[model samples]
Target: MVNIQKLRFFDCNCSVGRVAYPHLSDIPDVEGLLKEMGRAGIEEAMVYHTVARYGHPPAGNALLTEAIKNNPRLHPVWVLLPHHTGEMPHPGRLLPEMEKHHVGAARLYPGANYHNFSLSEWCSGELLGALEEAHIPLIVDMDTVSWEDVYKILDNHKQLPVITATCTYRNNRYIYPLLEKYDNLFVELSRFMGAGTIEDMVERFGSHHLLFGTNMPQYTGTAAVSLLTYSAIDRTAKQAIAGENLGNLLKEAWK
Candidate 1:
């Protein structure tokens, strides 16, 4: 068996604060999050606040910055809202603050229904244009954005990069078409449990499109790492999924 404890991994998806799931115990705070990362050999993670996904964006984004600003290991992902309603800062104003706080990416929570404005599957030309210019990629989960909406967004902004989280084995049919069409679309392998799916994705698409993300605190951080470690792909591909792919993406997003 591979010594998973010794392998350094980077988790692209993580969250802090309270989740409504009553069954989860020992929810990690900032310090506890670091400890959990240490135990799992996770070198770093891109995290969002649990509040950000379902609560007010400005408040949640502020809290996320406060929680992770001093730590490089925990890169914060800001939650965004439609600018027309003035619920959140426009991308013009937000990108500067994001740079100041060292945030690497942004997310949208369409399902939270906190506001009446819609994401239009990210098809808002004004919003998508702003993000494309800012160079920050969009992150979403199945609960937040639907596949049909995501398709609409991609159709309009082919150059805009997006990473979808909480994706699972059953999403293959939809994922394949997106992967085939958009070079900028990425999928996290954390919850993907389709048997032999990872190897197949690697074979069909290059390793660059597959990223490592553990829906941590809900799922064990080691779960994705273990799944990748024991997969049939070569070591380079495994390492890419572990950290390299995300590292390159982050570097490019800010450039």
Candidate 2:
């Protein structure tokens, strides 16, 4: 059996608040989430509000920011919208909120939540420009984002770091090329349960290009943890994928 008693993991993608679907099991709130993290051995995470993805960004972001206050282990990821409506904050006023909430990252979920805007340059160019300037990490899930749009965004904003989430083995056809083209791109590795593919990815791209994440509550963190724990990669590579890469990326955002 594989053991990871000493591994320190930092989960790069996670969410709180209730999802719109009632058929799914309930996800934990702040207190409960901490308990789940403790059990899973995930030392820290970059968490977004579940409502932020599907509902009002400010409301959910406020709730999440306040909930994790003074708790360094739970980092907040604010959801950003085009601000075409008066509901969300514009890029002009993001820095203060980020400072207040200690947020170093943001995400876009237009399609996931039924929002009717594009992440195209003409739509959110200013917001993307500001985030790129600040060096904040932007996470987009494969379920909601199109790779064609991702390519356009990456092509325009070469310096912005983007972390693609919830990818599976089938995504490699385009994903590998994106990785090669963009040094600033990082992949979240929990949903991509490709067995030995972890070793293959580490060999093709350095271990620093991947970050540990679990779609926790939706899936068991243990399953993903076990995969990494048993991989043929060396301890140094495993540790980097587990947490070090994420830690370094977070530091860069604040820098």
What are the C-alpha RMSDs, in order, of all predicted structures?
A: 2.3, 2.0
- Among these predictions, the greatest TM-score belongs to 2
Query: What does candidate 1's lDDT look like per residue over 51-168, in tens digits?
Result: 8776777888889888877888998898877776777667688678778877788888766454335667443557777777766878878766789878877777777788888897
Q: On a 0 to 100 scale, what is the lDDT of residue 161 in model 1?
A: 81
lDDT (CA) for every model shown?
0.80, 0.82
Tens-place lDDT per residue, model 2, 1-255, is 995357898898888888767436676587767777777878888898877778877888888887778888889999888866867677778666786667978898868445668888888898888888888988988889888878878888988888888988778777789988988888888778776778888899889888899877566677778778888999999999999988887787755
Least lDDT summed over 10 consecutive residues: which range in candidate 2?
A: 19-28
Q: On a 0 to 1 TM-score scale, where does candidate 2 land against the true structure? A: 0.93
What residue runs in model 1 are displaced by over 4 Å at the alpha carbon?
Answer: 1-7, 112-116, 121-123
Cα deviation at 174, candidate 1, in Å, is 0.4
Worst 10 residues of 1 by lDDT: 114-123
TM-score against truth, every candidate: 0.92, 0.93
TM-score, predicted candidate 1 vs. hidden true structure: 0.92
Deviation (Å) of 189 in candidate 2: 0.9
